[model samples]
Target: MENAPLPSKPHYAILDGLRGVAAVLVVIFHLFEAHATSHLDQIINHGYLAVDFFFLLSGFVIGYAYDDRWQKMSIGEFFKRRLVRLQPMVVMGMIVGAAFFYFQASKLFPMIAEVPVWKMLLVMLIGFTLLPLPPSLDIRGWQEMHPLDGPGWSLFFEYVANILYALFVRKFSNTALAVLVFLSACFLIHLTITGPNGDVIGGWSLTPEQLHVGFARVLYPFFAGLLLCRTIKLTRVNNAFLYCSLLILAVFAMPRIGGADRLWLNGLYESFSIIFVFPLIVFLGASGAVKSNFSARVCKFFGDISYPIYITHYPLIYTYTAWVQDNKIPIREAFPVALLVLASSVALAYACLKLYDEPVRRWLQKKLGPAKVYQKA
Candidate 1:
C-alpha cells in the first residue's frame, strides 16, 4: 500500500554538475597527493573537503526526495531503493580495485606485491559487503577499512547516515533537526580545532581514532543540509551553475589558514567552509536552471558518471601513485600519465555504467516490481 502514488520531484541539474566537478577535483587532489609529504603542501589542498560537500548534498537530496514520502514508504522500502541505486557501483568498484591490485606495486605499499592472490580475493570479497576489515587483515599498508578500494570507507559511513535516517533522524521535526545539527557542528568544530592535524582528514582506517574522525566528519553537514532543505527558499539566479561551480572550487582550493604554529586557524577555515559555504553553494545550484542545451547535456553527463567515477577511479590512482613512486618520477614528469589515468578513469566509469551498473539496476528495479524511484531529472 505504501509507495503507491508518491510523485518524485525533479533533481537540481546544476547541483549534479557541481558534484561531478568536486569528484574530478578529488581525483586531481589524489594525484597531487602522491607527490606531497603532508596536507599543507598537497597541490589541490582542500580537495578532501569534497567528502563533506558530498555529505551535505546527500542530506539535502535525501530530505528533498524522502521527507514528504514517509507516509507512503516504509523503512524496508527506503533501504531497498537506496541499495538498488548505490550497491551496484560499490560491487563493481571492489572488483576493479581487486583486478588492479597487482599493478599498484610501489615503495609506498611494497607489501602489495607480496599479498597473496587468495588474500587479495578475500579482501575483495569482504569489500563487496561494504564491511570494514581490521588492521591485521589490511592487505594494503594504508590501513583502509576496505583495503581493496580506499574510498569505500566513505561509502561505509554513507551507509551509516542512511541507516540513521531511516530509523531515527527522519522522525525529527524541523526545530529538533536544527538543534541536532547545531550540536553536531559544535562537536565537529572541537574535533577539527583541537586535533593534531587541524583538519577533518581521517576515517579510512579501522582505528578507534579514525572512527572518531569519521563520525566528526559526517554528522553535522549531513543533518544541516537536511535542515536547510526543510527551511530555506530557493530564488532564481543568473549563471548559477558557473557561479556555484566556481564557489565550490574556491572553497576546496583555499590555502591552509595558518602556518604550523597556529593549526587551529586551518581548522577554523575548514569548519566555516563546511558549515556555511557548502550549503550556500547547494542553495544557489538548486535555485538556478541550465539555460542552454550544452550546459544541460554537460550536467547530465557528469551527473550520470559522477558516482561511477567516484566509486571506481581510486584504484587507478593507487596504480598511478605506485608507478610514480616505483620509478622515482616527479609528478611533473608523470603529468602525461596522470592525464592518461584521468582519461582512463572517466572512460572506464562510462563503460561500467553502460555495461554493468545501469543494466543491473534496471534488472533489480524490474524484478522488484513497482516502487518509488527518486531519479535526477
Candidate 2:
C-alpha cells in the first residue's frame, strides 16, 4: 500500500483522535511515572512508545494530506506546509523547555555546568526547528529543537521522511522492501560497529558517534508508519476491536519497561523506538474503527494536544518530581499533583494550538502559495 493511490481525507476524526490517545497516554504515563512509583507505569510503561504511534500516524496523515500531489510535490511547498504546521509550537516548546531549565538550571540539568552557557544555548537553538539556517553549508545548525529533550529527535526525522516522500517517494519500487532494507542495514550496522554504548542509542548527545549511527535506526520506525499509512483501512467491529487490543497489549508491555528487570524494553525504547512500536500501531490504526464510545473523545482531545502535551509534560515531570523528592510528598499527593500537571498542560496546549498554531500556519501558507498538483512521475 506504500506505493498505492493515496487514501481519502477527513472523517478521520478517529485517526486524529487516536493521535490524541497516544498524546494523552504519554502524558498520563509521564504523570504516573513522575509521581509515586508504579508497576503500572513500568508494566504498562510501554506507553512511552506512543511516539512510535505518532510516527505511523504521521506517515498516513502525510499520505492522506498530500494524496493528490504525492508524485509531484515541490520540496519547498511540502516543507513550507510542514514548517507552518509544526514550527511555531515547536519553537515555543523549545523556548518553554529552555526557559524552564534555565530558571531551575541548578536543579534541572547538571550537564549544563560542564558546557559553557553559550554552548548550551547553541544546543537549544539547534534543537529548535523554528529557525532556518544559511545556505553556506557550514553553519551545521539544522538540529531541530530538543527543548523538550529526546522526543524532539523524531521531529527532525519526520521532516526528512516527509521531504523524501515529496522528492523520491514516487520512484521507489516496492517501497516496503526499501523500508525493510533500510531498517536492516541500520540495525545490523549499529550492532556490529558500536561500543557497548554507541551513539545511535541515546539522546544526551546527538553529534557523537552514537548519533552518526543511530539516525539510521530511526528510519525503520518512521517509514514503517509511512507504509502503514499507505495501506490502512477501517471497519466497524473488527477494526475497533483491534485498536483496543493493541492498547491492551501495550498496557501489558509497559511493566516490562521499568526497573532492573527491564533492560531490553528500556534498550528497545532507547535504541529502536520505531522498530519496536511502529508496526504495532500501524497494524492497529489501519484496522481500528472510530467507535461511538465515550473514550473516543479522550482519544481526540489527547491527540490534539499530543504535540503540546508531548513537549510540555517533561518539564512538569522533572520539576514536579524534584519537588516531590525534596518535600517527601506521599504517593497520594504526588499522584494528584501529576494529574494536575497533565490537565494544566492540555489546557496550555489548547491555547497554543488555537491561538498560535492555527494563525501562524495560515500566515505561512499564504506566503508560500498553494501546494503544487501532481504530474505523477
Candidate 3:
C-alpha cells in the first residue's frame, strides 16, 4: 500500500467523453456500412476509420486507468481484472453472433433444408477466435459479416495493447517521454518502409518489416495515449491538437489510406490524428474547454454510457440490417430505420448497463478487486 507508484484518481468524465466520441464514431461508421451495402460505396468508403478512433481512444483510457497502478500489482491480478471486464461481453457477443448467423442460415438454406452443420458452426468458431470474418460479396469490394459488425478487429487489438502496455509501458520511470519517443519513431519508420501488402518505399523510407513496423505504428498511439495520461496531468493539451484530431477524423473517411495511396501516407494521418485529437480530447476534458461547444450535459451523458455504447452497438447493426434486407426497404428509405437501429442500440446498451454492466463491473471489483497491472516477474 505504501509502495504504490502514485496515488491518483483519474477524471472519469474524460473517459465518459471519450466513450461518447468512440460510440458516435462507431455509429457513424455503421451508417456507412448501411449506405455502402444498401447503395453508397461509390460515393464514400472511409467509414471504417471509426475503428481507428476506437483503438486510439482505448489506448488513452487504458493509460489513464492503469499506467501508475501497473507497478503495484501482480500479473495475475492484471489479467483477472481484464478478464472480468472483457470476457462476459466477449463470450456473450460470440454466442449472440453465432445464434444470429444460425437464425439467418435457417431462413436462407433453412437449417432443416441445408445448413452445412459443420461449416455453420465453424464460422462462429473462427469469429470467436478473431480469425477472418465472412465478407458480404453482395456489398461492395468490402466484406461484411452478417449478424456482427466489422470493427471487432480493433477490440482484439485493444486487448493486445492493454496487455503490452501493462508489460512495457507500466515498467517505465519516465514512461511518458519514453513512449512518445518510441511510438513516434516507430510510426515514422513504418511509413518509410513498405509492406508485403505494398506500402510505399522510396526517397524517405525505412525497412519493409511489415509485422514489426505495422505493430509499432498501430500500437504506439495507445502507448502514446498511455503517456498522455501522464502528460495531461501536468500540461493542458494544446488547442491545435483538438482541431487536428477533428481534421484527421475527416481524413479518416478516405479509402485511399487503406489502398495503394497508403504506400506513401499510411501512418501520416494517424500521427497527425493522435497529435491533434488525443491531446485536444485531453485538453478539453481537463481544462473544461470547448470548441464549437456542445452542452456539458450532452457531453457528460455520452461519456457515461460510452463503454456500453462501444460494446453493444454492433449487434444492433447486424440485426437491423438483416431485417432491412429481408423486409425489402430501400436504402434511402431505410436510413430512418437504420437510425432507429442505432438509437435503439444505444438505449438498449445503456439500459443493460444500468441493469447489468455497471453492477457487473462493480461486482468484478468486489470479487476480483480493483483492476491492476504490473510487470511479470
Candidate 4:
C-alpha cells in the first residue's frame, strides 16, 4: 500500500490563473517580437521573463506536490508521474509545429524549402524525445534546438530541472536549499549583468553560450521556488488572483530599463524580479482564496488551458512571424492579423486540451496506473 498511488491534492487555483496570464502574455510578446530588431527594442520587453516565472512556479508546484510523498514514492515512480503529466503536450506541440512546418516557409525561414519531408519528420521525431538538436541538424535557419517548436527548448530544460529535483534536490534540508538558491541567484545575476545582450534570453539553442544561459536562467528560480515552498508561512490574501495577474502583466510589459548604454540596469531589473518579485507573487497567490464562484471559474478555466496554450501556440507564431518578415509589415498594419493569430492560438489550445491532452493523459494514467498522490497541506 505504501507504493500505491494516491488521489491528487487540490490545486492553488490562483497560481494556475497566474500561469495562464503569463502564457497569454508570452503569445503577445512573441507577436511583438516579430517586429523588434533586438532584445533592447522589443515591445512587451520583459515577456521573456515569463519563462523564469514559469520555472519558479514549476519548482514550487513540484515541491508542493511531491515533497511529502517521497517516503511512499520511488524516484522511478516520480519520473513516471512527471512524464505522464508533461510528455503528452510535448508530443502534440511538436506535431503542431510539423503540421505547420512548410506553411511557415518565407524569407525568414530560408531553409524550409530545402528541407525534405522525411527530414522534417525526422526533426519532429527528435523533438518528440525532447532532445536538443545540434546546430548542424537545424532544418530551420533560426538554429533552434527544436525548430519545429521554438518553445520546446524550454520544455527540454524543464525536464532537466525535474530530473535534478527528483534525483537529488528533493532531499536537501531547508537551509541547504536556501544556500543553493542563493548561489544560483548570484550566478544568475552575474550571467545576466555581464552577458553581451544584458538579458536572460537565448536559451533555445544548443550552443555552449546558450546552454550557459539556459542553466543560469533555470537554476535560481526553480530552486528558489523549492526553497520558498519549504520555508514560507502562508497568510490569507484578498484578490490574490487579480493582484498577482496584474503584477505578472506589469512585469512582463515593463519597458527595457537603462537602454543600450546601461544594459546592466536592465539585467538588475530582471534579477530583482526573479529573485524577489516572483516569489512574492507566488506566495501571495498561494495565500489567496477563491471565494467567489466567478473567480473560481476563471481560475479553473485559465489553469486548465495554461500549459496547453504555452506549449502549442508557438507554431502559429512561426507562421505569423514569417508573414510579418516577408512583407515587412509594421506593428500597426499587423495588429488585426496578430489579434486573429492570438485568437486562433487560444482556440487551438482549448481544442487540444479538451480533445487531445485531457483524453490522452487520462488514458496514459489509466494505463500506467497511479504513481503517488499527496493530500493538500
Cα lDDT tens digits for candidate 1, 1-377: 44364576788889888888898888888988888777877777899999999999999888998998888878888887888888899999999999998888778788898999999999998998899999999988988899888999998998899899889999999988989999999989999899998999989988999999999888998898889899999999889988988998898888777978889999999999999999999999999999899999999888888888899999999988887777788877999998998889899989999999989988987776545556631
Model 2, 184-244: lDDT tens digits are 5466345524434321333223455435443554455555555555655544445653465
Cα shift from native, residue 294, model 4 (Å): 1.0
Candidate numbers sorted by lDDT from highest down: 4, 1, 2, 3
Task: Give the lDDT of residue 39 in candidate 1.
Answer: 86
The per-model lDDT (C-alpha) reads 0.88, 0.55, 0.52, 0.90
Per-model TM-score versus the true fold: 0.97, 0.73, 0.68, 0.97
Pairwise TM-score winner, candidates 2 and 3: 2
**Local lDDT at 336 for model 2:** 70
Error of 3 at 55 (Å): 3.0
What ranges in model 2 sit over 4 Å off? Answer: 1-8, 35-43, 106-127, 130-150, 175-182, 185-201, 209-217, 231-253, 257-280, 288-299, 327-330, 371-377
RMSD of 1: 1.4
Q: Which runs of model 1 end up more than 4 angstroms from their true locations?
A: 2-5
Q: Candidate 1 at 298: error in angstroms?
A: 0.9
Task: Name the candidate that leads on lDDT.
Answer: 4
lDDT of 4 by residue, 1-377 (tens): 33487668878989888888899899999999999998778889999999999999999999999898887778888888888888899999999999999998889988999999999999999999999999999999888999999999888998999999988899899888888999999999998899887789889999999999999999999999988988899999998999999999889988999999999999999999999999999999999999999998998888888899999999999999999989999999999999999999899999999999878878987888864443111
Candidate 3: what lDDT?
0.52
Candidate 3: tens digits of C-alpha lDDT, residues 36-118:
54212323344444444455555666666665564566666666766666655554455555555544432222332344556
Regions of candidate 3 where Cα sits further than 4 Å from its true position? 1-12, 37-45, 103-150, 173-217, 232-267, 289-297, 319-330, 370-377
> How well does candidate 2 match the true structure, expressed as C-alpha RMSD?
6.6
